[model samples]
Target: MTTLYLLGSAAPPVLEISQVIEDAQGRGYDVCLGLTPSAARWLAPQLAELERLTGHPVRSEYKAPMTADVWPRADVALFAPATFNSINSWAMGFTSSFVVGYAAEAIGKRIPLVAMPCVNAAYAQHRALDRSIAELRGMGVTVLYGPGGFEPNQPGEYRAEGYPWGLALDVVGAMVSPTT
Candidate 1:
């Protein structure tokens, strides 16, 4: 099975990540999860269960220098519910958070990458968001934004159930499948 690195940020939709992981598993992926520090804190109570579900540790911070990687090599990475900060940090090469840090390096490693942002309309209005999206796209990262992807919701009107996780998974599935 293809190893998928499902990375997430501190967004409302992250609360439903268990379903996303199960959905990916249903599509035949060996899922390993990573998260931003804030997201990890948000899901703290369920971290052990999530690790059990994925059969891999939920990594939020960087491991020790000489330690071996816990998760298998990722065939593809799907970063969803990417917060505004995470996106900008990744595009700017800030490696503070393990989620954004891995995503930034994944570009140079040529790992197939897909990203979907979960930002409110107010946050979307920031000029940096557009620039970051464009930068990620230029780096060969498939960003699912705009009309066909994640549409920003109004401030304080988070619609967690409406997050397009299936769309992101579909794209990742296509990436790892053999195309005739």
Candidate 2:
């Protein structure tokens, strides 16, 4: 079984991350979600729904009693709608929350890490953010950004006509696919 660790952030776009989890579950991948404190405030209801749909718990802290291990052993880890703060924190080795802690643990184990950053152009274009992204890349993390020029509104508020949830599912598919 392929394990997918969905890391959360406080950014508004994280509200839609459950859709990606739901899509992956539909494809028969075992998915577990970890939420940051801010992310829980923005989208706990949606996270609850995802848990119901996926039949798995949504973890916010490491101490929470989970059915099984949910970190380090995941086949793939995706931090979608990652906030600028989260990008820097992860790059700097700050693992305070379950989301950050799980990512850090996964990095130690050399698990595939994918991050889709959601931030305004100014923050996204900042030198510090660039350096963080580069640092994560150096560590073999896949960083995905939305198209340039188009600005997304505040988190949990922006809505694209047809968001690319399928692409994320494709990535999960590839991560879970068996080698012949």
Predicted structure with the largest TM-score when compared to the true one: 1
Over 97-140, each residue of candidate 1 has an lDDT whose tens digit, in order, gives: 89998999899999999999999999999999999999999999
Indicate the TM-score of model 2: 0.81
> How many steric overlaps does candidate 2 have?
2
Candidate 1 Cα lDDT to native: 0.93
Candidate 2 ranges beyond 4 A from true positions: 64-72, 146-163, 178-180
Please give the lDDT score at residue 91 for candidate 1.
94
Cα TM-score per model = 0.96, 0.81
Clash-forming residue pairs, model 1:
none
In candidate 2 the C-alpha lDDT for residue 62 amounts to 73
Q: Evaluated with lDDT, which candidate comes out highest?
A: 1
